[model samples]
Target: GAGVSQSPSNKVTEKGKDVELRCDPISGHTALYWYRQSLGQGLEFLIYFQGNSAPDKSGLPSDRFSAERTGGSVSTLTIQRTQQEDSAVYLCASSLAPGGNEKLFFGSGTQLSVL
Candidate 1:
């Protein structure tokens, strides 16, 4: 895809189950980010990967949430021992580089439902 693509648009899991969401960014983009939007809440940054630099994970809500980008292309977000509060729309975005001036291309997102 020319733009960012995320798989499994909708997911329903039990409270204690673990889930993995995938994101495929644009082919040449060097910067990728993961964010989540909860009901009535703004986008929350979860992680950011830029080139070969260490990822910035300061925005992750909890220890249960983790993400990794491989070969600077595909990224995966994993939630362990998911809770009801973890339900949200997981969004992926990519840019040519990481900076305030760069425009980000975002995926439609994965809607997670924890029952």
Candidate 2:
């Protein structure tokens, strides 16, 4: 089974442009989450979706950031207006549940570079 995978392993974008990063989670995973890791900083939660419940987008840095999970599997993160500060590793993870005890399987993120 595929653990998790991200596209464009590396991305270089101009400022004010938009980019879409894709993620394919493992089969049968019910919980999907997106997080950003800047330089040496810790992982920051962005958005999460579980089954048919409303997505938790509280962690999204701004309105420029949005995401959607389709068919309870693949997910995509889109940045409306890219900025230099937005350059970071956009990681996607999935788990059985959103519990602290459950280990999140992480995907090799899409490295976005805003020039």
Candidate 3:
């Protein structure tokens, strides 16, 4: 793809249901990141993957949230037992480098809404 791609741009699920958001990063990019942007809130880092290894996953609010990157390309974010407070835009970004503040290309994101 020319840029990052995300699936199910808008999702409405009942509380306690589980949802999975997908992200496909640019080809040849070695770094993938997941972030959450709540209304009026700045982007919060959820996880980061360099190559095939994840060096950070500390930003996830709870154990109900998890992510993984496969083959150094696509990534998925799974939210279990969704709560009303979990509503937000799940954004995915990709960079060419492994560290530092490299320019990131972001997807449109999946807006998860827990009703």
Candidate 4:
């Protein structure tokens, strides 16, 4: 892809249902990140993958939330047993590399609605 791309720009799911959000980062980017933005709140870092290293999952809110990057390109964020509090815009960003002052390209985001 030309830039960071996310699928299912809008998703509505019932509480307790599981959902998967996909992201395709720029061709050469080695750093992919996932964030969540809730109403009236700031963007909260969820997870990040850097090259072949183990992903940083410390930012994930709970065990129900997990993300994985495949072949250093596409990434998927999965939320299990969704809750009302999970309703928010899930944003994906990618950078050239990690631990450096590099510019990050972000996708439009996937608005998840947990009803």
Using lDDT as the measure, which candidate wins? 3
The deviation in Å at residue 54 for candidate 4 is: 3.7
> Per-residue CA lDDT of candidate 2, range 20-42, in tens?
99989888888989999998899
> What are the lDDT figures for the candidates, one per model?
0.91, 0.89, 0.94, 0.92
Model 3's alpha-carbon lDDT is: 0.94
RMSD of 1: 1.1
Q: Model 3, range 7-110, lDDT digits (tens) per residue?
A: 98999999999999999999999999999999899899999999878899989999999998889999989999999999999999999987687899999999
Q: In candidate 3, residue 76 scores what lDDT?
A: 89
Report the number of backbone clashes for model 1.
Answer: 0
Q: TM-score each candidate.
A: 0.95, 0.93, 0.96, 0.95
Residue ranges of candidate 4 with Cα displaced over 4 Å: none
- In terms of lDDT, model 2 sits at 0.89
Query: What range of 10 consecutive residues in model 2 has the weakest lDDT sum?
Result: 48-57
Which stretches of model 3 miss by more than 4 angstroms? Answer: none
- For model 1, residues 60-80, the per-residue Cα lDDT tens digits are 889998888778788889999
In candidate 3, how many clashes are counted? Answer: 0
Worst 10 residues of 4 by lDDT: 50-59
Give the TM-score ranking, best first: 3, 4, 1, 2
- Stretches of candidate 2 off by over 4 Å are 52-54
Candidate 2: residue 55 lDDT (0-100): 60
Highest TM-score: give the candidate number. 3
